[model samples]
Target chain A: MSNLFFVDKISTENIQSIENEEAHHAIKVLRLSVGELVYVSDGHGKWISGPISEISKKSLAIRIENTGETHAEKPELVVVQAFTKSDRNKEMLELVTVSGADRIIPWSSQRSISKWQSDSREKWMITVKEACKQSKRFRVPIVNNQMSTNEILNEVKTGFAIVFHESAKEKFSEISLPANLDRIYLIVGPEGGITEEELQLFSTINATVVRLGAPILRSAHAGFAAMSALQTKIGRW
Target chain B: MSNLFFVDKISTENIQSIENEEAHHAIKVLRLSVGELVYVSDGHGKWISGPISEISKKSLAIRIENTGETHAEKPELVVVQAFTKSDRNKEMLELVTVSGADRIIPWSSQRSISKWQSDSREKWMITVKEACKQSKRFRVPIVNNQMSTNEILNEVKTGFAIVFHESAKEKFSEISLPANLDRIYLIVGPEGGITEEELQLFSTINATVVRLGAPILRSAHAGFAAMSALQTKIGRW
Candidate 1:
């Protein structure tokens, strides 16, 4: 796939305009011009690929040839990641985004060592967007604000909920996911582990506790492993 | 589990010595002394949890009480990663080790961006060892010497192999693993992707070509996703 630029004009008459950073990169850095093919995305699954018809200082207009929309795949994967150290949390966010999670939730578990800043949600969204462009995904994942354990329990009780614990009796693959589940919620605890109260809360709410196997993973890496295993088991991968 | 220190002698009379950096940490940093409890591992899978019997400037000897060996898990996973840029190649090595691959092979593919130096194997092992300790895995993954594509094919002909390709028609979840399989090889290409020649080689060897779904992962991140998915499929997750 070519470097895709996001634009607002997807169904424009004959020409679509590319502006902002996308335009600057094409004209100044890549030196793209008329007659050169530039892939464009509306960031809502709509995509267009055609030759550039007009190039000015601010924008490059592309002549539309063909356009298509990519449907989101299933079963959808949502990762609820605990707040860890700053850099490690970012690493986990980037890793899961690249691994193709449908949505990401920043969770503040009892044992979490880090606290979310006032701008933490916005910063996390930026990280998700950067990962989306890097992985060339046309659709950006929905990034949620920092959530308390009670808040997450309130939301996930309606879906298939999984809490990854080292002491869980059943392995992750052994759990039988019930049907009518369009999405799976993967709960990753902090490095120190979820407190007894937190585990009790989820257990009381009927969330299945599972283990990812022998090795203990950091808070950030667990989401990648859980999402991968769940996606494969749900037959989407 | 207490903080585990590796010892060269696990089957000693009653005293097991924890020397070198492990000793320094026990005595100096952790301020551990005799009569204190400490976990010890031989790293060949033998582990003992007992009290510290002797403490010196360079070593902390432990008294063996409970002794047991950890059995290696089934369906051993192996990742053959194509060499990429230095930092990314190291990142891939660290990722797969933490994901529980039993062995790793550095592949010098036709499109490899980085050449494996003569001492690269030793450096790669260091990365693997670091990841092992970080993940708290008792079993250390075997780091193999760098191999050309031809060499990998020669060695992998006996095992079930799956080459991850974006153009593959079947998803990784679609393949049925044969029973009694001792090992599985996951071939991951460089960022530029597998050349036609390389894909043809594995295809000719009857390796199943599979996709990990829609998003394109970096060469460093693909192995973790592939290993996690395959381990789940084989009932080891």
Candidate 2:
């Protein structure tokens, strides 16, 4: 199937016009003509199927014939990633989006190299949105603003919580999968790794300390690794 | 601990001299003095601890005091990755090294983008060595020259062989851990993914087909995910 674009609105009855950037992309880049079928998702669970009705240099029109619900329901997996440098954080965000994480919480730990500003949060959201589109995800993963360790612990819902640290004794496969749980929270530390106080806080909250393997992966790699392993173990993969 | 370098040889009795690029780096960049201690690994599992004996612009010398073995006696995990474009292949190689794979083999698949040449093999080995140094690994992962998929499959030793494919019914965690097997062969396909015939061939040879998750990950990302999961499951993490 061809890719679907997220648009503001589509006229379901007769002819729908795509203007500005979308129109330019369809007419100039893709060179779509009349009667060409395409799909458009509004990024809100509604997907519209249509064919090109009119094509122009500045605008293109398509008639929406039918609509379908695009809902991908999986066990919610929240990735709590400690703030890394800009490039590493971007790669981590893309991985999390493609890995089907339900939510992403940027965390501020003692060894974090990058700090989030109020203005940059919206820009980061755009990156997540693009990743979601590329990965064919119907709904975008929620990117939350920076939060402290205590704030994350307090906000965690009733589910299986795991903190991946190198010092942990239990491997991820050894942990018992929790029954009757719809969410899983995974916490990954910064480059220098989680501090003693952070580990103690997670322990106090009864979070399982899970270790991946012998080699020490970077902070970004560890997040994806943990998510993949946990999802496979829970049969959600 | 400071970063360690891999050298060709270490003498037991007299002062060991570092020449060429390494000497320049030690003398000019780090500005290490005569009494400072430094570490060196021979890349053959020998780690040497010594103090600087002499320092100069062209050469620096170190007197070896003690030597020890730093090899991990755990199971060997080999990652066979299909060749992609240069940038993506480099990223995959770095991930394999960082993820603690013992060896990395570049194989030509039906949809491989880049063709491997004999002259470029040395350059690829350098990339693997650099990745090993950056990841703080004493033993550098071996980078084999490019070969065909059938050639690789034929060379697989007695171990738990698995291929990560999206069409696989069983999740990687479903495979039972083998007790006496010390080698695990992980085969990761290209961007277009493994062909149906390749999957059937692997099945005919008793190689287990394993799936990572529901979301479609890029080829490089899939290799890291599989390696991380298998490492954790086998108690090597």
RMSD per prediction, one decimal? 2.2, 3.9
Instruction: Give the whole-model CA lDDT for all candidates, comma-separated.
Output: 0.84, 0.77
- Judging by lDDT against the true structure, name the best candidate: 1
Instruction: Please report how far candidate 1 places residue A121 from its true position, in Å.
Output: 1.5
Q: Residue pairs in steric clash, candidate 2?
A: A213-B237, A214-B237
Give residue A134's lDDT in candidate 1 (0 to 100). 72
Runs in model 1 deviating more than 4 A are A25-36, B25-38, B51-53
Off by over 4 Å in 2: A7-39, A42-75, A157-159, B9-20, B29-39, B48-75, B157-159, B177-179
What C-alpha RMSD does candidate 1 show over the true interface residues after superposing them?
A: 0.9
Report the lDDT tens digits of candidate 1 across residue range B21-80: 889988898898678877677666777878999887898778888777777866778899
The Cα error of candidate 1 at residue A136, in Å, is 1.6
What is the per-residue lDDT of model 2 for residues B1-237, given as tens digits with 9 covering 90 to 100?
A: 355667787666566777777777777877788888887777656677788887876987778887777686557788888887777867777778877788888879888887887766787788777776666677778888787878877866466788998888888878886687788889998888888988877787799888876656788777788887776676566
TM-score of each: 0.94, 0.84
Following a full C-alpha superposition, what root-mean-square deviation does model 1 have from the true structure?
2.2
